[model samples]
Each structure stands twice: as structure tokens, then as C-alpha cells.
Target: MPVLVATVIGLTLIGTTARDVVSVNPEIATAATVFCGIFVQALPFLVLGVVVSGAVATFVTPDRLARWLPRRPATAILTAGVGGATLPGCECGSVPIARRLFGDGTVGAAALTFMLAAPAINPVVLIATAVAFPGEPLMVLARCIASLLTAISMGALWAKFGQPRWITRNLLRPTQQQDSRFSTFTEAARHDFLQAASFLVVGAAAAAALHVLVPSWMFDHLAGQLLLGILVLAALAVVLALCSEADAFVAASLSMLPLVPRLVFLVVGPAIDIKLFAMQAGMFGRAFAIRFAPATLVVATTVATGVGLLILGAR
Candidate 1:
């Protein structure tokens, strides 16, 4: 209700002020449109993410998942990374599920893999990538492969050298120990959906604002420069903090950079971004999120660069 009222007042002010001004205030108009568009675009995804996340939290038990997996960390991580292909939601929804998995004693490599893969390799993200880069089946394939490799590699690295102390201290608690009425699938699903959706809305709104306010020419300076383009896009991804589901659309629209650079945009988004980092820090602890986010960023950028080169050569 407040948002609606604000929108009406804003529009009225803009309408009234336009006539009096010698020239229209493009910046103000652009800012308002961008802000509103972002809110609208992100609401649905945010709602969906929260519902799914809440459901997973409520229904899926730590013990149940543990029984379904092997004791080996490597095997568990592989399974978790690939399992993302089966999940339906975007990156925003994955954080809660990953946290839940960690809480359920599915920590270490497996939990990290789930965090990366669930957002990047999920069915929804893949389909969106395919649609975004038409006539380029390879783009989707590369994205999936790059994302999976990055997740798996990072998981393995963490398992080998990472100190247990660095892992999210909060997840050290036993999730199975918690008592809740979320035993039923319906209850778990509902809870997961709501939790994930709230974050998704926040992310999508930010991304939409970037889409409207940031001009395409801003990227023109980096066109055809892969390294600079990667850095710039990665920086933008951090600032925009867009959900994995909708980021491809924004990337596709950029059209200013080369295909490889655009690929980097999608790859870097899920693993490390400002919003995700903030959420992770808050939920997992500052120390854990800080280390994990930077590590993921470096690994994702390297893998994405390799994939980009491969695709460019093949073409």
C-alpha cells in the first residue's frame, strides 16, 4: 500500500514538473522508471524463492539427507553440485537451501557445492541462458559445464586445505536436533518458498534498477577487451546483486560486450555478489562468508575465462 501511494505521488510530481521545466529531467524520469520496474520484475521471483526455501527448511530433515549420501566428502560434493541441475529455482532461492543443508550436517564440500550449483546449473537458469543466447546451444552448455567445474573444484579445494574453523560456525550445530512440525512435504515446501522469495525480490529489484539506470554506453569503453570486460561485469554483478534466474536477460540486453564477457557476467553472479555475500555473512557468520565469497569469485572468474576462450575458438 505504501509503495503504491508513493508511486502515485511520484508520478504526479514528475508529470507536473515536466511542464514547468525548460527541458525534461531525463535522470529523474530514468531513475523512477528503473526503480519501479525493478520492484515489479523482482516481486514474483522473490515470492517464489521464499516459498521454496521455507518449504525445504520445514520438510527436509538432516538425517534423511545424510542417509541418502555417502560418507566420502568428495562423493558428497559431486552429488550436491550435479544435483543443482535438478532444482528448479534461481540463485536467490539456493542460499536458504544451502544453509539448511549445512545446518543438517551437510557441510564442507557438499554444502558449498550446493550453494554454487543450485543457482548456476539449475534447470531454470540453463533454460534462460539458452533463450538469452539464441542459436548458441554452446552458451548454455558452457555455462553449465563452467559452473559445475567451478563448484566441484572449489569444493574439493575447501575439503583439502580449508580449516574447519573457517566453516560457518553457526552450521556447526546439529540440524536434526531442532524440533519442528515441518515433517510433511507441504509444510516444508511452503516455508522454503516464502524464505527464498523474500531475498529474490530484493535481488531482482536491484538488478532491474541497474538495467534501467545504467546506460549501455558505459560498457562501450570496454568492448572487445575481454579482461577489462570481465572485471567490469564482475564489479557490476556485485553491485546489482541480481538473482540467477533473471540475470541472463540483463546480460543479454547489454549486447555491448562480446559473448565471452557476457558469459562471465552469468558465471560470476551466482558464486559471489554483494547481496548474497551479505546474506551468507549474516546467516553463516562474517568470517565464513568473507573467505568463501572471495574464493568463489576467483575460481569462478578463472573457469569462466577458460570456457569463454574455448567457445570463442570453437566458433
Candidate 2:
């Protein structure tokens, strides 16, 4: 399916008829190309994410994760932030995994940290970011640092103020299907890919439409107004609900926006997109999602802005 999609995109981009269409009705052609480009570019990483998510489901249980963490809240939070690299799935898959990992005290905090961090800072996502912006190694670094900090900050906040009552249950209640490991892996991978890919299609379409409709002058204005740019991009991120694995390419495609706003988009999208909000609501309960999702958006935006200033420096 991905290959077929890629082939179609290639034909549209390079074929003479496509060029004629672009010249005749540029906006529609441009939007189509942008949408296809983002989707095709992101497909491989999305596949990789689903595969890794399946492996996580098959091999890594909540009990094993809990056993690995330190007892101290701060240390456990830090550990979980770093350990997020181990789960290379998108935010969709991480929600349920985090649900399984959620518990009392330090472990619960770590679970939340892992949920926020895994989607943004994992190896596959960082690699995709690097690929999307080949000239900007600092973008990858900034994303990693900013995402980690956001995760840890949220974890710390939860440690200090989070009520067990906010969650559906204080104890983790993981799936108990009596299935073979291969069966589990296949089922997990298939489900995640379908759900995540559907959301990715929506994001790509939104990005493509906005690319054509939003004027270049507005982007320049936002670039000049840093705070406004941050807020706008952050809001767009949530509304677009892009998959973590694919968001970098979409950010890269928005050439009019400067790196800082784009960075905010990348960070915020993975941490607290609309789909993630829905997933959190379904998995962790509405009470938890309402508080946690909003906080995550703020923290992710702030941390990404800070990191971008320090690292990318409005460039």
C-alpha cells in the first residue's frame, strides 16, 4: 500500500500531465503534491513505529517495566524519560502502554513520563527528524532535550499534585488475553498502524490545505512575533493531531515558518494532539485526560520554545 502511494506521488510530481495541471490550477496541484509528499515521506517511519509497538506489546510487560525502575520519584522519572527511547511507537500506542505502566507513587509518575517522552524522543522519531531536516542537526537535539524535559516536568508535577482518584484506577490492569506471542505482536501492530495511519492522513490533509490557504506574509509575521508563532503552531499541532513518526516531515514542509515555531509544532503534536487526547480519555479516563493533556500542551510548548532558543536560536 505504501509503495503504491509512493508510486502515485512520484508520478504526480514528475509526470508532464501533472506539471500541466500544476500550471493550470496551481493551488490544487500544490496542495495535492504537499499532501502526498508528507504522507509518502512519513509512511516508512509509521510502519517502523507500529512494528516496534508490536514488539513492545509482545515482549515488554508492565511488571517487567516496574521491576526495572528505581523507587525514588525523581530518579524514576529521569529514568523513565531516558527509557522512553526504548519504545519507538507513536503516541497512539503509548497511551495503552502507559495505562499498563501506571501505578502508585514513583511508578505512576514514571508511567506518565514514559507516555509523554516515548512518542517524541524515541530513536525512530529522532532519526526521522534528522532525515526531514538534513541541514539541521540541532533540530533533532532540541527536540530530544525539550521533549525529555517536558516529560520529567510533568512527572514531577504529578508526583507533587496528581491524585490517584484522577486515574481510572491506581493499579495497572493490563490485557490478559491468552494468545501466542506472534499473535499478540501481529494484532497489536495491525491495530496501531490502522489507527495511527488514519490520523496521519487527516494531519497530512490539514497541513496541505493550510499550506495553500495561509499566506506567506502571515508566516513572516509570526516569525517576527515569536510568542504568537509559538502559540499558533502549538495550537495547530493539537488540532492537526499528527503522528509522532510523521510530524517532522510536515514541519519541514512548512518552509515559511521559522524553526522555533516548527519546533513547537513538532514537540506539542506528539505530546498532546487531539487523537492522543481521545486515547488518553479512553484509556486513562476523562478526568485524567482533561488535566494531563492541557498541562502537557503547555509544558511541551514552553520546553520546546526554550530549547529552540538555546539550540536553533530563531534560525
Candidate 3:
């Protein structure tokens, strides 16, 4: 609520006739269109995520998760990735869910893997990708494979090198331990939506500003340079902080760029963004987020680029 009020105030301060100015300026009009398109397209999915995440809080227990995953780290990571593909929601909900599922040793790795994988490769995101890139099936496959690998790799790395002490916050707390199931459901949904909405507005504003400010030639330059394109798009994903369900459309909007770079954008957005970083720092700890977020970005970008090369080629 505060975020929204501040944004409204900021806009009003820009000018009382801001809408009139925007309508007259071609570049500003274009940016406004893109922002509206992304926000409107993503809003339904965001709501759905809130509802599903609430349900996840209500029903998905640590004991149930333990039963589902294998004991060994390798197998558990794999299983967690597959399991994540089943859950259809956004990254915000996954944070607390991951907190609930967090455990020692191998299980801890599995929970983190599930957190990364669920948002990027889940059925909802996959379908959205396919819809966004109707004629390109390889794009869908590349995103799925790359996102899955990123999750699994992170899990393996954490299992091998991550220290529990780094997680300075209460990384493991039963979300519904003290509350009734119905209260938990409503509260979880409300909290997730409130947390996500403010970030969504900020992200959309950044995207809109970039759309208007970036030189037209800049996008043209990205088209020919494959590696640079990949890196730029991945970084854009972090900057935009778009919802997983809506990023594909944003990527698709950049029809000027090659499919591989757009794939990197899709793969990286849900994995690590400003909002996710904030959520991680708030939910887990700054100590954990500072280390984990950067690592995930590198891993996601590298994995996405590699998979894109293999599956979609440098084209």
C-alpha cells in the first residue's frame, strides 16, 4: 500500500498532465504501451500464484516433502527439480515454502533446488513460453533444460560447499506451525501478493524507462553479438524482475533479438532478480542472499547460455 501510494505521488509530481504528455510523445507512448501490456498480461498469473502459494503454505509439510524426495543429494536434487515442475506458482511463494522445506544435509539442497526450479520450469511457465513463442518449440525446451540444470547445479554446489552458518536468519520455520490451516492459507496468500505487488510496480517502471531511454541502435547491436546478447538479456532479467509467467512475453516483445538471448532472459528472471533478492534477504537473511543470489545468477546465465548453444545454436 505504501509503495503504491509513493509511486502515485511520484507520478503526480512528474506533472499533472503526465498522461497528456505521454500520449503526445511517441517514445513515451511506446514505453507506456509496453508497460501496460506486461503488467496486464502478468496480473492474472500473479494472482493465481498468490492463491496457489497460499495453498502450498496450507498443505505442503516438511514431512511430506521428505517422503517425496530421495535420501542422496544427487537423486534428491533431480527429484526436487521434477517435483518443482509440477507446482505452478511464482518465486515469492517459493521462498517461504523453501524455508519450510529447508533441512540439513541433502534435504536442504533439495529444498533450494525446488525453489529455483518450480518458478522457471513449472508447467505454467512452460505453457506461457510456448504461447509466447508459438512457432519455436526449441525455445521452450531450451528454457526448461537450462532452468532445470541451473537448479540441480546449485543444489549440488550447495551440498558440497555451502555452510549452514551462512543462513543467518531463521531459514527453517514451520509457516503454519502456530496457525490453523484456513488462517494460514489466507495470510500466506495476502502476504505473498502484498510482497510481490510493490516489486512488480518497481520492475515494470524500470522496464518502461529502459524501453524509452535505450537507443534503438542498442537493440540492433545486440542482434549480431551472441554472447553479448545473452549476457545483456540475463542482466535485463535481473533488472526487470518480471514474474516467471510473464517474462516470456516480455522476451517475445524483443523480436529484434535472437531466440537464445531471449531464452537466457526467461531462464534468469525467475531465478534471481531485485525482488527475489529482497525477498531472500527478508525471508532468509542478508548473509545468505548476498552469496546465494549472485551465485544463482552466474549459474543460471552460464547454464542457459550452454543449453541455448546446444539446443538453439548461436543463431
Worst 10 residues of 2 by lDDT: 168-177
Q: Write the per-residue lDDT of candidate 1 for residues 20-65, one digit (tens) a residue.
A: 4514666555545554454555455445544554455455544465
The residue-by-residue lDDT of candidate 3 on 97-186, one tens digit each, is: 787778788988998999999888877788878877889999999999999999999999999988888877774444656788999889
Count clashing residue pairs in model 1: 24
Give the candidate order by descending TM-score. Answer: 2, 3, 1
Candidate 2 ranges with C-alpha deviation above 4 Å:
1-23, 169-176
Superposed on all Cα atoms, model 2 deviates from the true structure by an RMSD in Å of: 3.6
Model 2, residue 47: displacement in angstroms?
A: 1.0
Regions of model 1 farther than 4 Å from truth: 1-58, 89-93, 103-107, 171-218, 312-315
| Whole-model lDDT, model 1 | 0.69
Q: Candidate 2 residues 71-144, lDDT tens each?
A: 98999999999999976766877777788888888988999999899888999999999999999899999999
Best by TM-score: 2
As a whole number from 0 to 100, the lDDT of residue 141 in candidate 2 is 95
